[model samples]
Target chain A: MTRAVTIIGLLLTVIIGAGTYWVSHEVERLEKRYAGIQSEILAEQESIHVLQAEWSYLNNPERIERLSQEYLSLAQIDTLQMASIDDLPENADQHLYRLDKFGEAVAFLPVPRTRPGDLMPDEAAEAMIIDAPSVANAGGNQ
Target chain B: MSFMRFSYWLRGDRPELRPEQRERLAIETARNRIFITGAMFFVGFTWISYGLLDASVLRQGNEPAVASGTDTRELKTERADIVDRNGILLATDLPTNSLYADARVVKDPVESADLLLTALPDLDRDTLIRHLSSRKAFVWLRRNLTPEQQYQVNSLGIPGLNFQREERRVYPHGRLFAHTLGFTDIDNNGIAGVEREFDNELRINNGPLQLSLDTRVQYALEEEVQKAMETYSAAGAAGLVMDVYTGEVIGMTSLPDFDPHRPGQAPADARFNRTTLGVYEMGSVFKLFNTAIALETGSANLNSVFDATEPLRIARFSIRDYHAENRWLTVPEILVHSSNIGSARMAMAFGGETQQKYLKKLGMLEKPEIELPEVGGPLLPHPWREINTMTISYGHGIAVTPLQVVNGISTIVNGGIRRPSTIVKQDGAPAGERVFSRKTSDLMRRLMRLVVTDGSGKKAEVAGYFLGGKTGTSEKLVNGRYVKNARMSTFVAAFPMQDPKYVVLVTLDEPKGTKETYGFATAGWVSAPAVGKVVTRIAPLLGIEPANAKAPEIEQALQIELRKGERKLASF
Candidate 1:
């Protein structure tokens, strides 16, 4: 019994030592990762500071105004062009154009359209009727 | 075993015993050994735990060492940034590398100097060679170099050359915000302007210091003033835009301005801040105060007439009208026509003491309270006599900074509340001292509007924005005498006269007459038109909608009733 108790104590010490060694090694690895992340954050912050300064320099009013004058045909807003909401048309439906309906009406017009294959049956019929005259003109020329 | 046997023999305690007794003695010895070992382990663990606790919790309050290295003591004290109200960066610190040389380490001074000179052509070659050749341990060659330049110098791979990281105070907007932000010295010390005024706060605080200035408004004001200076061939020009209700200076410009990056190269006159530092006899704009005070003190009313058939003679100094209306003029007419004789009569009616009280209440008796280190105190008349009062009423004897004039007018037009002018943004509408009654302020606003509509300030009238202002054309005092042709024309204006929001003041020193102005170099011809252009440009930016000119409420607010035969005289 004395020998067994001595053996168990020795085994417990060995297990505890192994566990402590593993925990310390894991801690060191995590600490290295944490240091790397901290350095990355510092590097990112420095770049952000540099970028902010460059952004402000590029967006300076004097430079923007000169660029606008050289490249863009924009002018200063005149007071006469500004109108309050009260001056808008009373009938909102009449003023606002429905893009879908307008698209159907001008389906045969020689303009580029998105998703040309998604036309409804009625729109297809209208487009054919509008294109008939142009098609006949092509046939007569041939 | 020998020592134990000797101790037993010395005590003379040898006795024959049974096996059980021997075992009991062995157990006692073993128990004592285990107890001693446990005690030693406990003490060692407790001491270590105490040390860990002391290191973490007890010493936590100690400050981290800020002085990292001997060479970086001045550069490491990080300063707070300065930004406009809209968060556009005006001033900030940029970390840059400054080149230094260790003369002892330099192998070949001639080749190093040649290579360095090629990279930095601006540096004097002889000076650099001297610095590199000297036996000094360390010598500074250049400061605040660009990253590209530092890389180019580093690529040379010279042994003696080294770089020390330094902080440079950079003004990103350069001359655009020169006078307002001021500039720092080479050591990053605040030398002038708001930078000097709030140096302590900037050094201690880690957050950005926000100013009340709007860059958009500042650029517009500066552009207009620059155009005016060039068109009129004036010596210098100053312009200010202030929020009347809060006394916040939105934009202030004084030209010719210098770039803050190299303030040493600029002339002393360019560095002078005219808006706050230069005091001028701001001519007829002071008449707004005269009229407001007369109406406020019940000394004169809108309909009260002042005899202006001849110039008013007060002692040896006489006050004459610039545009003489040789007749009895009413209160509104005096301001509309900018009649100095009529303003003098009004001042006399109120007496000199009353005028002093009014001017003092308007914050014109002292230096303007603004967030700038270079503020000029008002040059007040020494004796405080009758002649001084009459001339001061028409803005001759008393001289004040342009900022004071703008603030004083802001007080009158912003419903008589006097708020100290500020360049820092406030939390909300600041509480102000009531200088004039609301009724008096309203009446003053109406009279100012009348000046724009049918008076000498007609040149300042915009189509949609209701602008009311006063014109002052005073001959600049040169060598104790007024120079007749060297006139300082000033125009002070408040926009949307029905309920004023902003007060703009434009002043031109010695503006020459152009053919477009028909040889008239007066405030009405020069400064008034500039004020009109500034108000038109800034109003839309401030989100102030243009109201109809025929709007009934505005018409009712600005309508003036004419007396019998007064309509004929109004045609002037």
Candidate 2:
């Protein structure tokens, strides 16, 4: 009887030990996966930060204005310049074509050298550049 | 028998009824007890393992026994509202009931379809009849039903009739900004416009989508262009307004526009985006760029002169001026006069390769980089033969979209920075790619002003604000040939030309001359006046003070010079 009791106790102990080992292994694997998720989440958060900064940098109004003038050399146009065909020059070649340096074909416009102050701030510029009229509401040419 | 032999014999099978038998019985009892106890422990362990698993899954909400069907997921998200930049609701998702049926449970298919058609007269009875009679387990009777229809359908309550929740995309503004804002399909998928471009990002996020476009600006721009279209009896018109600094597209409209809500009903041509998508041979507008390119490359200066006395003929093609002055014209005069011969001569002087390089740098020889799905690729001449160079100098042999011209002009007037145009409201974006030299850009700005004040674009001017632009008139190509009667009239202009903040481009396709415009459908007659009206309307809204109303000092530098004699260079 005593021997029978010993065998039964040994079997019980083996079962419990095996179950414990299996559970511990599973738990370890889960913890590793959890850690991986945490790191990835951190990386995404960093990327968002970068994107926000990039957006702000790209849409700066002062910078864009500076660049526009530096590149296109366009000034505010005048009413006379925007006249109708009735007022057009008599000759077709008088307003027909011009040469381009890059050698590609292009239409031509005479340069307007009107200064900055002549422009009136339009909704197109105010709404586009800063996107907020309340903060920067000056309408006259800068 | 000896005592040992007797014991051995007694221990044998014959001793079962003796003391040995009693001992064996006790051992068997203990072994049975152990076996029972082990079985109980094993069973208990198994039960505990199963219980733990059940608890784990239940805690994680992964219970397999619970059936989570379509109804649950359907109720999770309310549809998002779509609004214009000015807080005008263009589209909205409203809660509506939809009819569904379990075909297996339906007893009378014909009767049910008849009842459904009565409740929703828009539905075709024959089609519904077939669908309801199908062997399929489930079928959709109707989607996006009105409350009244839902009630009527439910009252009939044919056993299989079921009401399901669904969303419908609604466009409140109808057709105003249809082509630009775009519309969602039946499944609420954005197939075009700003919606398609930013589809994934906009799906779950319901925050206001701030666009660069202004509703008022859009209205004004559209109204003027439409007026021009009607007056000139034109085929179509397209106009765009852009912020010079940030490259934000404020108002873009194309005639023959379709209502996004009813895109399928509109003709394909009306749905086309002429501003950013349609590549046209933009006529004399090319000359502006050509002149800028020349000045930028040190091939010429404002004081330099080109001989326009005779047309330059090469092979079979002749490059001549429509209005031949037959005399020497200075660099500025060539642009103001729009002298094709003079410009071509200057191009030959600069050489083909140099001109190609500069135009590419100015974002003219490629597709304009804008945040839209309908961008047109630049129509460049292959092999770039010498004839191509000559024709290109006068806005022929190559084609580009209106947006490219705007960007090109922006590069010139915005001090040579080729900022990529954007539709989304970027409070502060990065400095886009630099495409030109500042000096070249400045020189180009002066030339553009000369055109508007003393050149063909005089009609595009706004008195109070110094406006400068170039007018272009190109014959539309039809079936591999240029149609003589049809022309695309275009104007590109900037305000306060000295330091440009905005560029406005207007185009009319195949317009017929009206008596008011002196039988002329040229850009100076059609597009120029349209831009003028736009500038007049939006000027007040944009906070630009009228010239007479503005404080005095601000207008000090605004001058329109008409010089008859040679003017000496005033050194900066």
**TM-scores computed on chain B for all candidates:** 0.88, 0.79
Lowest lDDT 10-residue stretch of candidate 1 chain B: B67-76
TM-score of chain A of 2: 0.39
User: What TM-score would each prediction reach against the true structure?
Assistant: 0.84, 0.65
Interface RMSD of each: 20.7, 18.7
Best by TM-score: 1
Tell me the spans in candidate 1 whose CA falls farther than 4 Å from its real position.
A1-8, A92-142, B1-77, B562-572
Per-residue lDDT of model 1, residues B109-222, tens digit only:
888999888889899988988888997889999988999999999998988999998888887778888999998988888989988999998888567899999888998899
Best by DockQ: 1
- In candidate 1, the residue pairs with backbone N, CA or C atoms under 3 Å apart (3 or more residues apart, or in different chains) clash, namely B284-B472
Write one digit per residue (lDDT tens) for candidate 2, span B1-572.
57866875554423336787867866776787799999999999999988998898656665567444332212122334455455555455555678888888888989888777777889888888888888677788777877788888888878877888776665554566877877778887878887787777567755646787876677778878888888888898899888888888888899978878678888999989888889999988999888877877788876676777788899898888866778878887887888888888888888899888888877777778887788889888889989888889889988999988887887788877777888766676448666667877776776777787667877776766667888899899987699986999998888766667778888999988765555667787778878877887776656654443144543333333433323334511
Model 2, residue B427: distance off in Å is 1.9
Predicted model with the maximum lDDT: 1
Model 1 residue A140 CA deviation (Å) reads: 82
